[model samples]
Target: MSSFFAAIFLLGLCLANAIDFTTVYEWNKFDFVRPSGVDTSNGQIGQHFHQDQVYFQYMAVFGERLFLSLDSYSGIPATLVWLPTSGSSTVPPKLAPFPSWNLHMKDNCDTIQAAKGMEIDTDGRLWVLDQGSSKCSSKLWIFDLLNNDTTELVHQFPDSVVSHRYFKRELRDMVLDKTPEDYLAYITDSFSDKIVVYSRKMDKSWTVTTPGRKWNSLALSPDGEATQLYLARYFSNELYSVSVSELKNEGGRAAVKLVGEWFNIPCRMLIDSANVLYAAFKYQSYLSKWKNISEPFRDQRFYEVERLDAEQPFTFALDTNGTLWLTERNATGSEKRHKIIKAAVGARSYLFKPSTAMTAPQAYVSGGETSDDMKITQTPTVIVISLLVCCLFLCGSCQCVVNLVRMRRKQTSLRQISKDNREQRSALVPVNL
Candidate 1:
């Protein structure tokens, strides 16, 4: 019996290895398709090009487009770019500037200066942080990926929030505190050690300072107003947390509590809709996850490679398609190549989950769900239930009562299914961590 069980476990591992990380793209070096095949080789067009200088800082997948945020300066041409994910050819596709090439032009106050960090929300919107450089002002750019790549909103950062020394400053990471009532963005500035909070409704941003410098990563819980913001710093073993409500105070004064200590310093972190916290360690090849703050931390070896140093996942993002996409940087030598790998993680990002609790009738029927907004409240649900009860009580004939109950149940099921249709379509099968 024990031998049979061992064989079954081995078979499971074999199956996982087969389906996980079916190499989406393996690029030797990044390239962009120039319009009309124009070669800007000899410092042409005033934007000097070097394929080696540009590197991907962040990536987010929405629908058919895979967006990449690159580290840009005077040497790099575009800070924000994208590549099409749907293609049959095995050749690596070239990166194209997102929105347009004009938006990436240098020194333009309206153009993206340094898109170092980015996040794609559940609403299919791309939120990017343009870390200002060389006199170009810092700004946040949001583009609607679902609606023909429309310009959604642009909120330029003030010197007071990001810093007047924009050239030296860097926005390390970005995360969203998306609730039903409000949409907020929390961005980390490494040079000043502050988290800049931006609000969509007010079109205003505020700054919050913490104890650590070189604040590298930030993760937000999906607990609505009760959400907890996780913080990690470069070369720091201790992790910290602060409530989102505290950070939103008018005075911008909040007490950041130490969550716990880590065995390895986490360089990047992600929290999914399932409340699972996943992290990529600085010097480790494998990613780790924590069920909760108190649960035992486990290292997940989803991707295996011969050289542990070659394939350390630097950044991670979960899409609505139930796939987890991440970028691995092998900055060892001249020949080392960066890779974009993915696995079926069966989870969604924190942005897609319900931030606030809805006190409505949860799926009493098997696959029942709420409306699109999940706006089902307690009072309305109660009133609806009461009306149904009265209808049954008033109906005298058995046939009439049966018919009405069936009709009402069917209607409720349809309403619930449509309610949850937009957000909860990902595969729910749990993979071994």
Candidate 2:
């Protein structure tokens, strides 16, 4: 009976590992025929240049359309393309420029210089981060997907927000907070090592510079009430988190705490309904999942989902139907081909499981009280002291109690020093200690 049960358990584990990630589309070079008489000089290329002049930088899905943004780093025109999601052609037919050609001209106010990253909200609105063309200012553009197969520009960041700083900045990725009372947008400026926050209600924005060099990716915690923001640096394996409430209250250079660390620098991350964080590595070409977000990093909670043989997965998107999509780009920038892959990771329900309560780290403030969410809770020393006092009342052995108290005090002091060192390393600004 014991052997039979063991065999059945092993079979179940094997079946769970059988899920395969399917490659939906791959192209050596993006080949498609444009409309007749379409000029290839300025913004009228018949197709993406056969050489490595064009590269797919980001992707997003809305309804029946699958949208891709082309990188302008190679001097190609900044453009976005959309095709029917149901089509499965080796070379996609009718790949049309998004919005319209009128919006792509240099003199137009709606012209996009370069779009590096994008996000689609729950209301079907597309938010694009324009990295700024040579002649244009960096801005964020929001478009509403209308029912008539067209889009309307709803909002654009003012010139005041983009032109405030004299130094060059590169806005990379964004995450949205759609709480009822607070609708905020957070964007990462990789080049400047800053995080920019925009408040929709107030129509205002602010910037916070972090301690690291390349702060690339951002994700919101699964908890709705206490929505903490998770940030990952590009070249480092460390992951950090900060409270959204604290950021809004204390604006510039707010302190951040180290939450978890991963094996590789994650290029893109997605937090599912179950609070599971899925990280995609750029050069490593493997997908990993951290199951328990509140716990410290451990090999037990981290699982390697799948490995891409040769392709490097960059940007990722989760569709309405719970399908995961990734853009596999040529990491070396030498290969001309790229791909789009999809898989079902079994997250489908409308209701998300409540996230486990996270223990907040101790933070030092200048004068004001520490934020409620940043306050550290009961420590092991408190429990030990309480037990020692109880023994004093019950048995009252003076010599034995003195030795135990001295030993615990030494241990507690050592622990405090270690914690202080960690806190110093995690602060966004230099600490006096």
Candidate 3:
């Protein structure tokens, strides 16, 4: 009996270790190709393209294409582009622009001056925050991705709500309110340490400030309503939250409350529909997850999920396919190149409601109960049959343990998989027609 319990415990440990992210798509550096047939790798006339100048910051998966936001202020060909989902995981695909090549013109008021963080809504609309150049004012750009990438809304921030010192780059991160009453955007303006709130229905903007500056990441709880806005500041382990009700005030006096504080400083944060919170520490090798928001963040509630070669997950996103996608840190001196890593979450993104959470069984769930329940009656013949069944089961217990060990070994060996391992839809064309 003790041996049977030991085997069961070993199987549980194996399942926990199996839920991890492995390297999928990787590149020493990114490549960009414009719609007009201009390749950045070709070294065109008067064009300067440096391999060290460009790096990806944030990403959002809409349907079949994974959109990436390039965080570069100079020498980058395109700041916003995408890669197909059905391509070779080993081969780095040439990134195609989001909508068109013309929209990426630098310092143009009519185009995206600087592409920063972005989020995709359930309606298939891509909401982008553009840190405008010295030649243009900061603005918000939304595109109807479901409708041929048509223009949805373009609004410029007035001087009253923006920081005079860092107006061109103060906007750091933003999260949309999921309440059905009205649409609001809570954006982090780190230059002045303010949370800029914008109302889509009223077309008005306001600002809210918490304790620390350098506000880096923002996540909304999976309640499917504007309950709390989770905020993480750089170089800090304490997480804070503000009520959406108080944030809706144009008066700009929303109260900031400290919710949970742990040992790890979460550089990036994400929430799944199951209400599990993920945190990726800056320059840290391991990633963590918090199961309950109601309880204080302690070692018992927060668990380290994975670790890889001291790999740093700077940016990440949870998709509907039950995958957590992230970008690792890369440097010119380091032998490792920039790579896209993924893990199995077994739950959809927080963008979906909890009741509507979509899930697919993954390696974490593959080793679950695979046998059916048995029943026995009072008959002597039935008792004899049950004894025979129990004798046969006892004989096969060793094989069951062997199969469980083999299942875990199989998951560990094949770390890398080609394509998005979940479900494959028709790949989106790289070029926009």
Candidate 4:
């Protein structure tokens, strides 16, 4: 019994060590090409054609539509391109001028240079943030697809908002309110350390500070009850977040509370139907998923699902099925149309990185049974069987020790009996002689 227990215990330990490394996602790059003789106006151009245009700042997807904003220096012709779900099905989707938005006549691709962030409103109005003129410009362009017109310009940062201070090359991205509201918008200015909120009713006239000014990229929680904001430092690759109640005014003040932080640089972010955050950073071209971010998911928290190193541009949107849509820009410069790759959450490459909350061993260990239950509630039952086997083996090891002791005592008795028999036989033979 003891030996059996010992064997079982050893087996349990070996099984524990035999667990394979956790599964991580691996992504493949899909290339969409331009059909022969197709118009490449708003088409994606790679470094092969324009070596100077190295950066693709922002990209957004609404329904079957896809859009991207290029850098001012990028020699790429069109500022933005619109893509669809079904098409000629052969080459990259054709490109046309992203229909002009508010301030159309005043808006030139030059003034709208370096469009960093974009959002599509409930009415299908395309809102784009132009870091305008490498100087201070607080204008956002709104293109109304419903009316096929440029509706209105939202001035997120006005000279008054800047308080007469010169903030050149400001304004990064814009985050839209998720819950049904009166159309509120949040804009981040990397240089100014502030987020400007604009209301559509006011015609983009008013500007207020946002929760965090240090980083860019904001996401709406799945329930649309709160906002998740990401602040990524360019220098150190530190990514953080702040959560704001979707319904609450920033305490009558524009303030952001920090919540989540990760080690890598998160340059861009998008939210899925479940509210998981997909972060694309400059560290590597691979996309990562921060699954199930908490409300007010603040800075210094978030899990990393998986990442790809291929130099593909990252963009996010949901398909008709509400599955997350991911597109990557090809830098190979091999095709006329910059590739627009599509990936659904079902893709093998899709990953879920639990927040430190999920992966922190110490936190769970310290939390007692409640914490352990919360952590593995969804895990399979095989884990319990494994534990039981380990326990059984440990119990058997004690019985094996007892059986060995009894076997030793029996051997000693046998030896004593044999010695006594031999002495009696010798005495009988001597007396007869």
True-vs-predicted CA distance for residue 420, candidate 1, Å: 79
Question: Residue-wise lDDT of candidate 2 within 1-433, one digit each (tens)?
Answer: 4534644555454433333345555666554335565544565353434445556666788787777777654534446767565554345344466666545554344576667677777677777777666566677777777545345443444454444232466677787777776557888877666678777677667776666645878777764777778888867778888887766752467578887688777777777655667776656656677665666654222223334343335667766655566666654545655666565555521123343322232221112221222222335674466445544443444456667989999999999999999888898676688
- Per-residue lDDT of candidate 4, residues 361-422 (tens digit): 11111121211132222233555666667667666766777788899999999999999999
Worst 10 residues of 3 by lDDT: 368-377
Q: Write the per-residue lDDT of candidate 3 for residues 201-224, one digit (tens) a residue.
A: 777777765545557778887764
Q: Candidate 4: misplaced stretches above 4 Å?
A: 1-55, 100-111, 134-136, 149-156, 162-167, 178-181, 205-213, 223-230, 233-255, 295-313, 329-338, 346-433
lDDT of 1 by residue, 168-213 (tens): 5777789987777778898888776677899988999988766555
> 84, model 1: CA deviation in Å?
1.7
- Candidate 2's TM-score reads 0.69
| Quality of model 4 by C-alpha lDDT | 0.50
Q: How displaced is residue 4 in candidate 3, in Å?
A: 8.2
Instruction: Say what the RMSD of model 1 is.
Output: 20.3
- Itemize residue pairs with steric clashes in candidate 1: 224-355, 369-416, 370-419, 371-419, 372-419
Question: How do the candidates rank by lDDT, highest first?
Answer: 1, 3, 2, 4
Q: Give me the candidate number with maximum lDDT.
A: 1
TM-score of candidate 1 to 2 decimals? 0.72
C-alpha lDDT of residue 111 in model 2 = 72
Query: How displaced is residue 141 in candidate 1, in Å?
Result: 0.8
